[model samples]
Target: MKVDSVTEKAVKAVLDKFAESYARRDLKSAMSLIAPDDDVVIYGTGADEKRVGQEAIKTQFERDWAQIEDPGLEYNWISISAAGNVAWVAIDAVLKAKVDGQNLKFQSRITMVLEKRGDRWLIVQGHFSFPDQSQFFD
Candidate 1:
């Protein structure tokens, strides 16, 4: 489906904010971008969990981030399409994290869905995959 330039730009702006938020570990800023009743669905080999509502996500991440150090995300926005009120962002990125003495890195490809609720866009769903241990994006 072809989207007008305006719709495409709008989607891009939201996606940019999403990436920057994770990079900064600014959960408050990220949560502000999401809709109040947003739902997030994540699909991966080790972590398969569906997070519903913005508050649930906020609570979970607040706790999760508290346990980590220098948690940063780098996302390459591959594609974003919008039809009416719903939009999807396809991304490939690397997540670098540290848990106490252990350091970890993972390559991730994810699709995030956002919905326009009133005057703002909210992240409603996300499906993520890790394609092999080798770096796929670089």
Candidate 2:
């Protein structure tokens, strides 16, 4: 289904808030936006990491956040589309930080499917992967 401008804006709010939470490392606030039964998946060149449930997701994020210093994200682009009870959000962002005193940066493209539960939208599935710069912005 074609997503209206207002719906797009609302979805963008969620994405922006998520990015803000990452930049601030506010684990509690960040997880609050996610669905309770969210299935978070992270895939790159290495083994795929999958976490279920909000508690586990929060723990994983907190651990990961602890390892990085000066976390910031540059959201290159994001598109939100709706289909039935689910909202598909595609995002490209650069996660920048210093890991173990070494400058670390990577461009990641993330796709999240959020299912609407009553009046709130909760994430059902998440896919995150590191991609090349050329594959990012364009």
Candidate 3:
């Protein structure tokens, strides 16, 4: 796949908006970035976070925002590629938040597939995971 600057910029904008939703805890805005179809799916890091459709994804976002405080992310790096109207992105990030009155940070990895519909690029499939830092892997 070719890495088109124009397409990459558009995809990056959508990804940025998604991260902003985490910070602002705005479910409506987040949902707007996702495709409004049943095919939309997101496999989150949680063991039970395989969400499909808009309602399921919305519930997951709400649960996460309610559980964490001062949510933010350090977008370390991103790789984007596009073909036609479809774009894919892989990102390395650090999640920062306050949980149970304790400040915490965790490394996160995100991959998403977006489809350009009209003038907007909407996320149609996404998978989010925290890298396993187990000694066994080392």
Candidate 4:
């Protein structure tokens, strides 16, 4: 189904808010964008990094925030599609921060699935990873 301009704008706003919250290290604001359901999932850039459920996600974020300082995030929105109450967003993002006294940077492709709850959109699943090149040589 074709996504209308209003749906696109609303989803974009939510995504932008999430990035802004993360850059500012405002955990509460960041978490507010995520669904509180037990089925919510988040996959980090690491090969095996996955967090399930709101509690697990919160714990992982706390640990990550403890090691990161002065965060900076840039999100290049690729696309957004919505069907009924669900929306998917794709973005290319760069994150930079000071971690353990060292500067760290990551460039990743991100996908987020959001479900409309009442009048607000809440992220239900999020995945972040570097572009995979394995398919090119296959």
User: Quick one: best lDDT, which candidate?
Assistant: 3
Q: Candidate 1 residues 1-138, lDDT tens each? A: 566688777777777787678667888888877666544543433463446677777765676577677777677656777789888878887877798868887788888888888767777776666787665575
- Per-candidate Cα lDDT values, in order, are 0.72, 0.75, 0.92, 0.86
For residues 7-120, could you state the per-residue lDDT of candidate 4 as single tens digits? 998998998898888888788998999999999999987665799998888887787777689777788656889999999988988888897788887777899999999999
RMSD (CA, Å), each prediction: 3.4, 3.2, 1.3, 2.5
- Clashes per model (N, Cα, C within 3 A): 1, 0, 0, 0
Which 10 consecutive residues of model 4 have the lowest summed lDDT?
A: 129-138
Name the lDDT of candidate 3: 0.92
lDDT for position 109 in model 4: 88
lDDT (10s digit) by residue, model 2, range 1-138:
788776677677777887799889998778867877544543322353566777767766777678789888789988789977778988888888889898888888888887777866766677777865465453
Model 4 score (lDDT): 0.86
Which regions of candidate 2 are displaced past 4 Å? 38-48, 132-138
**Model 3 weakest 10-residue run by lDDT:** 129-138
**Candidate 3 residue-wise lDDT, 3-94, digit = tens:** 78888888989989988987899888999999999979999889999999999999998888888999997789998988899999899999
Two-way lDDT contest, 1 vs 4, winner:
4
Comparison by lDDT, 2 against 3, better one: 3
Location of the lowest summed lDDT over 10 successive residues in candidate 1: 41-50
Q: How does each model score on TM-score?
A: 0.76, 0.83, 0.95, 0.87
The regions of model 3 sitting more than 4 angstroms off are 135-138
Better of 1 and 2 by lDDT: 2
